[model samples]
Target: MRLASLSLRYKILDFLYKVYPEAVEELTIIHVFYEYHTVDDIKKHLNYLVDKGYIEQKEICLRLGTKKTTNIYKITSKGIDLMQGIIQDKAIPIPEDE
Candidate 1:
């Protein structure tokens, strides 16, 4: 079954936050481990993060008698702030819902 966009987004966040510091590649086998079928879905979430200023992207072209485009991704300061917020929020004790 396909994962929800929210789940995918969190998985992405966890990946970038803990697993891979350099999660720049357009296609990653590790994404499949996180239940991503293709790069398009992952790219969609990455674009959303970029639009929200939680991340940044850089385009690098390869020349080998042909042009190849690759996207390089990096978590921005805003993303680090977001992560810290999440950590703090999780640290606070809250009553469990019955």
Candidate 2:
């Protein structure tokens, strides 16, 4: 379970890194992993990233028709550093291909 959680976190960071500077909607992130993980599981990993200062989360309100609030996540400088090997977290193992 612990390994799985770490892998999920790493993948989340990787995805966010690939799209750096662009925030991803919560639903979109969840949808990407819906086949193997529950919404709650994906949320938990997102929260973990936020708490670690590796990612930033913000709530955006859309007024298209009605007021709708949603979360958007983006990787932070620290997260980029981790991806670049300037910093490291044992839990999130760096991928070799990177």
Q: For residue 55, what is the lDDT in candidate 2?
A: 98
Per TM-score, the best of the predicted structures is 2
Q: Model 1 residue 4 lDDT?
A: 67
lDDT tens digits by residue: candidate 2, 2-94: 788788999899999999889999999999988888889899999999999999999988666678889999999999999899998998888
CA displacement after TM-score superposition, residue 10 of candidate 1 (Å): 1.7
| Tens digit per residue, CA lDDT, model 1, 1-98 | 23365556555655566644675555552355445345676777778877877677887776666689777777777666666664322322222330
Please give the RMSD of candidate 1 to the true structure: 6.1
Question: What would the TM-scores of all predictions be?
Answer: 0.64, 0.91
For every candidate structure, what is the RMSD over all alpha carbons to the true structure, in angstroms?
6.1, 1.5
C-alpha positional error of residue 33 in candidate 2 after TM-score superposition, expressed in Å: 1.3
Candidate 1, residue 47: how far the Cα is off, in Å = 0.9
Clashing pairs in 1: none
Tell me the deviation in Å of residue 67 in model 2: 3.4
